[model samples]
Target: MITIQYAIIGGTGVYDSGVASIQKTVNTEYGKVEVDIAEVEGTSMVFLARHGKEHGIPPHLINYRANIKALQELGVQHIFATAAVGSLNPDYPTGSLVVLSDFMEMTKQRPLTFFEGGTDDVKHVNMDDPYCGNLRKHLLEAAKLHKIQFKGNAVYLCTEGPRFETEAEIRMMRKWGADVVGMTSVPEVVLAKELGMCYASVGFVVNMATGMESGPIQLESIGDMLARNKEKVNKMFLDIFSKTLDQQNCGCADSIVCL
Candidate 1:
């Protein structure tokens, strides 16, 4: 029985658990969740590759429930998620990092909660503050420590995909005040709240959205961009681990009302 206080959900460009000293698969009601247990800067943590180690699973197909449940079982209290996103807002250009302050769910399908039928009554979790403020503050502090330029606040719009969003969809998201767009942040963020875990997401802007550029959306370029800028994301997490992994003054643990 391995225990950890923090967990990292690594998104695109972050596949391998960098300093993981142990690797294991956790069985859950939803599915088997693969995780890596690591010690970074003397702080013990767990890492889960959101897209799988091989990048085999798509965003819509990820076993979100199992992943979240496994972390909960491991005694994880704070979750830091990283995402490679497209900039919907012009101010957040490519190569910029945005700490998600809020999110808009545009996903059409997927199980969004754990209290479907296991409880006596329906469980409705409060989402007034979806992203944990304490964790976000820490991340921002880490960025400042490293002198890494980042957007302190941004609204993430999550779209269901193995496919990218169209130009019109990007426009709509921008109109809705979304700064960044991605595929995996929806149920993941929501589920963390359900478990009373403080969750924060750091998004790396890989490109401008479909219509933001004059030419056709280059699918190949996104990968190249992520590869080129993943180090910034890596450094941000490392700094967070070294500087701010222990501060948990928020009410995330009390967010669950009907457990």
Candidate 2:
């Protein structure tokens, strides 16, 4: 049985366990999940590729429940997720990084919780502040240490996707106060909270939304941008994990107020 207290869910351009010192697969009730465990700067951490090691899984089809449950079973206490997003707010341009403080779930089909039956029953987890504030503080500090330019806060709009959003959809999301748009942050964030884990997301603005740019969105351009900024993103992750190993002081553990 492998034991780890912290984990990172890699998204988009981050598909492999490059930082992991040990890689293994763990079986859970939901399914068998693969994870990589690594120790950086004396801090042990686990890394899980949210879209699988080859980016084979689509956003709406991700096994969020199995992923989160596998981490919980491994004794994970805090989770840091990385997402590649399209900017909805003009001020947050491509290549910029944003720490997600909240999210709007626009996903239509996906199981959003762990308490669907059994002895655990149903739990109405408090999502008043979905992302962990304490974890966010550490992430911001890490970004500053590395001199990585990042927005302190942003509202993430989680959409159902394998396909990019339409121009009209982007417009409505922006009107709803979403600073960045992505597809996989929904059930992943919520499921973490349900398991008493502190969760925070770091979003890399890979491109402007559908109608935000004058010309059509280019897939090649987005790929090039991510490839260029990949190092900075990796540095930010290292710094955060090296600094935030303890979560005893955070409110994330008490998220479930009712059962």
Candidate 3:
């Protein structure tokens, strides 16, 4: 019965920390998920590999509702999610980091909300500003202090797929003001919001979006880059985790009524 205040849910490979110790596999309404509890500076936090430990779960196949519910049940109040994304903006190249400030959901078919059920009534969660402001600010400050080159802000586009988006889709998203493109982050952000948890996303640029990249997309090479850049990603989280816990209230910490 370990109580954790913060939870990090993202790709499996992103958390290869040798220190992470598996606490237990939490069985939820949706499915069973392995939850790892670790200590950073004596603060206990939970980590869940969004995909299974072996990276078996695809973006569209993620049991988002179950994952969020499991964390909420564990009393987690803040969530930091990471995703490997393709940069729509030329300035944001491979290995670059972006603290997502906003997101556009182009994903469908996946369950997008928690208010639907036989017993649960209809509810709408306000997302005027999706990412948690306080957490984002703290992360930016940490990046500066750590001398980590972090792009201050970004608009992440959430798409549905195991497959990457086509060049035409990327072009359309850029026109719609998207700065980054990825398959995850839609329901993940929205679910955290509905749970009254402060949530923010960190996007690690794996490559330039379709058409922008040289030659064809080589996922293996991108995976290698992400692997090489994992240290920086870990450091960013370490900084964010240490800083954000001290703040009292953020706009993201507040809640609104559904109409």
Best by lDDT: 2
For 118-227, candidate 2 gives per-residue lDDT tens digits of: 77656688988799988888877777777877865889998888688899998898889999999999999999998889999888898898999988876676667676
Model 1 Cα lDDT, one tens digit per residue, 158-177 = 98987888999888888899
Clashes of each: 0, 0, 0
Q: What is the lDDT of residue 89 in candidate 3?
A: 94
**Which regions in candidate 2 have their CA more than 4 angstroms from the true location?**
none
Clashing pairs in model 1, backbone N/Cα/C closer than 3 A: none
| Model 3, TM vs. native | 0.92
Q: Worst ten-residue run, lDDT, model 3?
A: 246-255
How well does each candidate superpose onto the true structure, as a TM-score?
0.92, 0.93, 0.92
Give the lDDT of residue 258 in candidate 3. 51
RMSD, one per candidate, in order: 2.0, 1.7, 1.9
TM-score, prediction 2: 0.93
Better of 2 and 3 by TM-score: 2
